[model samples]
Target: MLRTSLTFILLTIIFSSQKPKKNGVKDLFKESFYIGVAVNGQQVSGKEAGALPLIEEHFNSLSPENGLKWSLVHPKPEVYSFDFGDAYVALGEKMDAFTIGHCLVWHQQVPNWVFENESGEPLDKDKLLARMEDHIQTVAGRYKGKIDGWDVVNEVFNEDGTFRESKWYQIAGKDFIKNAFRKAYEVDPAAELYYNDYNVWKASKRAGILKLAKEMKAEGIRVDAIGMQGHYTLGGPSLDEIEKGIIEIAEAGFKVVITELDVDVLPRPNNSEGADLNINFANSPEYNPFVNGISPEAEAKLAQRYADLFQLFQKHKDKITRVTLWGLHDGKSWLNNFPVRGRTNYPLLFDRDLKLKEDVFAKLKVVSKQ
Candidate 1:
């Protein structure tokens, strides 16, 4: 008995003396905010083995990239498909990760039948409100306790901060945004409801978002956080702008989520933003400069960009609740095909082969230590 006790104590001391391995981003920011990744159907279905381990190690929250959207999950009015969404929610549950439903209301990816009557004419306000309520209630109710949060509305405001005159707004005005949140909250009071948008760092857009957040609060809607889709580029939208936006949102009494974050390292067209999926010019050598690969210097700049943003995130960790990478690996990032088609864009922390860019994590670890 005495020999056994002495051997166990010796082993424990040796193990405790060894430095712990830094597994992934989750380990680095475990105490601060949830590190998250947007997942596709393949990752949710147990395929993409290479990316799965990295996701499990690095991220504590999962957002379905397209699984929960209206067109994909619910094509017809009375019919709903939950196959991919169910698998996604199940994966998050099994991993004990926070599951985020991508969106409940959006101007895009919605079926034509949503805003049209049987004769293809636009529906009136009453009809549109009913449809919106039904969709939110059914979907939010399905995964009520399982899903941690929902992006109740997405990208409804234009770059100039005016409400995008979409079918929703044309019919219901800003009440669409209000009713989406109210319905989602009514169905699942426990779930965190968010209004998510891209390019929210712009001064005009920031004002519009703060107005929406304030309106939600004033109206007693359960608006928990604002998802600033941080699809940034390497040199523009300076770090100061990013920090200022986060602080402003938090000061307005809402948690901030750095959602859909990726730093595009490629050259852009004259009027193109990094995440503008609609700007498709014919393929050209000038647009696709880095077809072969990103240069070493360019790679260094990307790493530094991530480090700078993360340092800001860590500094305001209290007001921030999550930081979600738009995608897991460079090979799968939508930036490759957006604004220009078939260009090799290295925008994620993981390489095309699903290997961690060591320097990126190294920079973050340095920040964490400081």
Candidate 2:
């Protein structure tokens, strides 16, 4: 009886000490993932400190890619404010977590005035292309060694798996993305460069990316990785597609990542009054249970979704460079105001009550066992 009790005690101590992954950075590149979150003003406050402890529990990285966009870092020309971004990076460093700069060039966030001439008319091809180059050089150059990687570009594809028309494409033609890569490399050669997009597992978008990658390589441009923006609904990509996609990306000379991941649980049956209250969640063919709020049953589904993904992640650990969540918790998520407004959505690995959801906790525990 004494022997049994002592054995149990020893096991508990060993498990407690090694609750987090044993190797922090060593095995990171090999069969490891970088869980992370996006933060806003509320998260930075003292009042919310206790609410964010789960961060230390799961994440090993920080991505304020949105917080450091053109609007915040340098709201105007010539002046720069690293206060917010620096704080986030400092947190990452303190936590021994990896840090990533979101993007150097994007079509949406730039002030409208950037595209206009003195008379307020939009710039022509030559001028717009020049502007794009300057934007890339300035942002990428500033963060040089500090950032491990840059998104380079984001959401360049449409829902039906098509590239949207943008000023970059209009002015520099196809060379805009290529030049963005070239200039980012020029400033910070060591930083990993990624081609990030949504719905990347689909046939049309992935095929276009293949063509784009070939074009870039032919022009001597190197794409270091592919960011599969995993902002998915209840039924994300099937297990087979994920396996095949990861293998294919690595085969194409790029690393794979589950970027911008979140499993949104929005109820169905279309509350016509709440029609627009949503995030990136689509309203059509509504889910059967109407995931208005994550019930105990809904939590089970959410947990299973993460577990299944993590299991597949284990399978492709060789090629997957990192796996990131879109935000820290449900409360601060942009999902609250995005595609749908006034609706409460539970799309994170944790619940709103700040308690560990069993499924998510179980998934991490599974990761630890390996």
Candidate 3:
């Protein structure tokens, strides 16, 4: 009888160990921080029906890929389209997920009329500031209590720690940034406002952002967090550099959000690092080598890269509030056409079929536990 009981007990243990985990990625990191994914228009509009289930299962926060951008949302000065934006917010509400507004001001994708008059002359400082205020009030006010946060300003600083010479800067100077935060706060004081940018891991850019955050705090502006766009490549931006940025930003009394997180497992031209929309390289056969799919070896490397990133995030969970993947799946990733157009890139956690990359998912789960 004792021998039979021991055999049954051992069998039960083995079966239990092999059972699949009921928790998804969000549940795994629920106590640590929010796991988020960017949803495109199709998913929000129910065209990509498969994505809803996957998004609801794994993520606790939602950010629109382009639904809320200035170009799409308010393409022309007299036009404002909220079809996708409304649906996106509704989906977030349905899932009880944290909803994020992508941006209120950016250098790219903005209409030229925003910076110019009816006859194509540039608006003066006061007029331009007025237009900015109007844009903020109208769009932000439309979703005041709905959106949990807004990336109020994006990519305003260059990699060398200097401000970009965008029309906003040229016309209104740095006050445009300050006014953006202030206007956003005035419109919806409850929503968290963030300054988001790519290549933030660079030491100089990090310093510049922190300095701006401090100045805003001193002026009583409500800047809630700093978003480090994790548009990283596999072989660059050493883990140490990323961790340092996280630590310093948190030490500066601002929450750290790993916004737009993705690992580009493709080669790039020399000196191509940040997510500047203007930077484009000629498409060549060399850049599009993975036309079919990545090899097993490349897949393993990608998984390991994500493992390391999640491990770092988990270690600094006390300081980091959210980690958001840039797209729902590899198919929807902007990297596919970025830097070199027509390149097949594998940069997201999910495959083209909307299925989770099991290897990468497993690594993330293990690292979260550690």
Q: Candidate 1 residues 1-370, lDDT tens each? A: 9999999999999999999866788888888899999999888887887777788889999999988999998899899999998898998998899889999999889999999899999999989999989998888889989999999999888888899888899899999899888899899999998999988888788898889889889988889999999888888788888888898998999999988999889878885763545668767888777888888999899999999999989999999999999999999898888777888899999999898999999998888765
Query: How high is each candidate's TM-score?
Result: 0.93, 0.82, 0.94
What are the runs in model 3 whose C-alpha is more than 4 Å off? 1-21
Each prediction's whole-model lDDT (CA)? 0.89, 0.69, 0.91
Q: Per-residue lDDT tens digits of candidate 2, residues 17-46? A: 885744322233234666666665455433
Q: Order candidates by lDDT, high to low.
A: 3, 1, 2
Model 2 RMSD, rounded to 1 decimal: 6.4
Evaluate model 2: give its TM-score: 0.82
Which digits, one per residue and each the tens of the lDDT, describe model 3 over residues 23-142?
A: 788988999999999989898888886988899989999998888989998889889999988888888889998899998999988989999998999999999999988999999999
Deviation (Å) of 141 in candidate 3: 0.7
- Judged by TM-score relative to the true structure, which candidate is superior, 2 or 3? 3
Candidate 3 Cα deviation (angstroms), residue 212: 1.3
Model 1 local distance difference test score: 0.89
Worst 10 residues of 1 by lDDT: 271-280
Q: Please report how far candidate 3 places residue 196 from its true position, in Å.
A: 0.2
What count of clashes does model 2 give? Answer: 11
